[model samples]
Target chain A: MKNNKNTVDPFENEPDFLAQFDKKTPFSVPDHYFESLPEVINDKILKKKSLKFGFDKMSYRILGPSAALIALFFVVFHFYNTPSGNTVQPEEFSDALLNEVSVELDDYMIYDVYAEIIEETESSTEQTSGNETENDEYIDYLLENDIDINTIIEEL
Target chain B: MEHYSDDQLLSMFAARESANYAFNLIVRKYQERLYWHIRRMVIDHDDADDVLQNTFIKAWKGLDNFKNESQLYTWLYRIATNETITFLNKKRKRFLISFHDVEGELTGSLEQDHHFSGKEIELKLQKAILTLPEKQRLVFNMKYYDDMKYEDMSQILNTSVGALKASYHHAVKKIEEYFKNH
Candidate 1:
């Protein structure tokens, strides 16, 4: 059998249409560009984080004093508005008047006159009882004590 | 065996007075991902570096206020997206360019950058993407490049899943057309 194989030089017969595009423009990054990037970034981030953390800690510390001052202010405000225990009641009007009069009338004659009037008022109420015999027993007790009946009657 | 989730790390960082471990762990985990994401958006390495630093700093400060409604990565993504957009908006203002015009400028710059590998291919793709509106480009990046599901993307972008799907499909058709033409 005769050898009838055809041979072709792949690079020879082609047009140079893509020759300009075949020239490679290499992309070169700086040496250790990405390798040192992490450390640089870490340093920057560390500095930023420290400044932020410092400010936050300062604010946190300030919160304690701020809260204390607010609580103290509220306590003082409450105390200033609260009423004292010694305020007089409406039902004690007559008692107040009597106490005032007693304080003003400290003389022995005034005291004697008030005491005689009270004694006469008590005897008159006793005499109005339904039984005359009970009134007689009260009169007997007053007589035995030698009480001043005219003085008490004059006062009444 | 006791690997901490992002939420747990954040909570530990917030609650403890000395949580360098937690904070450092977060930095180690997310730095490259965030860096690349911001780099793609901003189109400048130095700008991406600044934005990445600001992002992590903001994350550390705002960690306590983060509710666990979304995953921690998604929350961070939302922040990063907002930051990148805001930075671009400011840059646009400074250059007196509209957002679409800014994307055109970025595409031109990226196409000419010598350090980008597969520059021609990536430029073709980026130019095609630049033809899209801002929101559509963002959607395409998240879906096509990042392979983010619509659910996670919805949480990050605050857009409806249906709208994202439409945006992504439109972006794909536009890119396909560009490829066919070029």
Candidate 2:
């Protein structure tokens, strides 16, 4: 029996019975099975994707109100517990910290804070005037305060 | 009828627009080989089709995370192998049958299957193969029928080359013995 140099046939020395039998599969597929397989696979994939998307959309529809209710509960709890509040509210604390920061920095920094509060307003120092020193100072202040500028930006 | 290398296909898959197209090309390229591999194990065309569909669906979901640590075909073979085994196991569990019972059922199915057009000796050989322990049967089919090298078989089966060689050797002996008795 001919074999690739890399692959040795273990049945080479076996009886002729094994060697003589053709290794062709006995099974047959439906006509045009191979021709249509890719399209069938694509359809199944599309169907699965659409089903998953539908399920996700349904889940959001079902869970959206529940999430909003949970968030509302936290908000109500925060408002009522303010008198006894020992836990620092991240938003309020960050706001107060930034206000102090604006006072200590240039007047333009205050405009930066205001710009973030309303999306339409442009920051006075949008480019930081290409001022590397002031940029370094602003980043340093953020680091020292354990602040995430993105969190503050998103909240505003 | 263009043939693309695995690297080319994978890179095309990286782009959102061509991902589906690349995947289709991949399916067309490997479907026949994988289909036969699965069909041999399940011994039924419809069951093979279900298992094949499942194998590709799995490959689609997992392809992004495939690290290219192994050849693409080998990775796909591993999935097909695993999916076939899972399909068989599920069948046994669904019917509450033992391993030996399932083998008997598969052999019975083979007898009745209109698609099985094997000659007499080939049918006997297939029945003998079904008697093997599942892993040994896998080793024999890959070695005897597919002419798969031990290294590739080792990767696909996640077995040591020595172990696979030994398994194939034992499988051949058993099939020969089965022919003697029958």
Candidate 3:
């Protein structure tokens, strides 16, 4: 018997064996689809970053003007309400002088009380020192007037 | 003219003011391969299109960091695979479907889809593949469809070769059994 296995061609018998899968190619992608991808992506990233940077810069810029305006408004408002260049009238001057007089009177009262306390303390201290000095002078006179008691007793 | 490697092409694009030529070359080289890889995973043309664009965009942005340790195609494949998987995961999350149920639903959809060329056969095959656990399905796809060596697959997937072999064998047996039963 001739080898029947050798006679049979595996490929010949199954012409359409792999046909179902034949249509399936290595899934191909379209051409040049990603060529512009980098530019698109870079543009997006750069635009986003730039927008954020610009917004930050603009906010600081806006704040600079706003802060300056606020400061200027404050200064202008202060100066506008301020009494300057002989703006005080006679009545205002009189009212201010009255307030100054009251303040001076209060200061004078405080000084008067302080002076009285200081004078009283000084007089008391002087009296005490005078008495001490008198005692010292008497002691000195007694010492000078005293003869030698031992010599007198010996003579007796 | 000598064909430029992916790294070479990318460098040319980076250096040249008009990188369209080099970039176009990269697209031509990778598009078909990436499309099919994503198409098989996402199973929708529109989803595949979005993922493909995202993959290339990511590649373009990350090309500066690409060290050329692996082949450029492999690196792109990694990105494409990750994007497809991430898209599927997000879709599943949006749909509030369990991961297990997502596979079942995808299989059912494949079976009913008319857009697939070999609808019945491909659906049957896909359904059988869907029956596999996620890792096994990944292994089977890489091994059976992409014809990737286990060593390369291990490198791409960061799995042990032994583990991948077992997963592939299990997937193949399960699929063969499914075909037998059906």
Q: Best candidate per lDDT, number? A: 2
Judge candidate 2 at residue B23 and give its lDDT.
Answer: 98
CAPRI quality of model 3: incorrect
**What is residue A61's positional error in candidate 3, in angstroms?**
9.3
In angstroms, how far off is B83's CA in candidate 2? 0.7
Comparing 2 and 3 on lDDT, the stronger one: 2
Candidate 2 residue pairs in clash (backbone atoms < 3 Å): none
Query: What interface Cα RMSD is found for model 2?
Result: 2.0
- The positional error of residue A17 in candidate 2, measured at the CA in angstroms, is 4.6
Q: Write the number of the candidate with greater TM-score, choosing between 1 and 2.
A: 2
Residue B120 of model 3, lDDT score: 60
Residues B17-128, candidate 1, lDDT per residue (tens digit)?
6466777778777777677667667766677777888887788778777887889888888888888888889889999998689988887767666546655575676677
Clashing pairs in 3: A27-B32, A28-B32, A29-B31, A29-B32
Look at candidate 1 and give me any clashing residue pairs. none
DockQ head-to-head 1 vs 2, winner: 2
Predicted candidate 1 versus true structure: per-residue lDDT over A41-119, tens digit per residue? 7788778768989888877898778988999999999997765565333224225444543223223333344444445
**Across residues B1-182, which tens digit of lDDT does each residue of candidate 3 receive?**
35788768978888757465666667667776787777777666667878887887787667767786887787888898889889989989999999888888777666655456564676677777788877788777777677777777777778888788777766777887888899
Best by TM-score: 2
lDDT for each residue of candidate 2 in B1-182, tens digit (9 for 90 to 100): 89999999999998989999999999999999999888888898999999999999999999999887999999999999999999999999999999888989999989988988889988898899999999998888888778898899999999999898888888888998998999
Deviation of model 2 at B56, angstroms: 0.3
- Candidate 2 C-alpha error for residue B52, in Å: 0.3
Off by over 4 Å in 1: A1-28, A46-156, B1-3
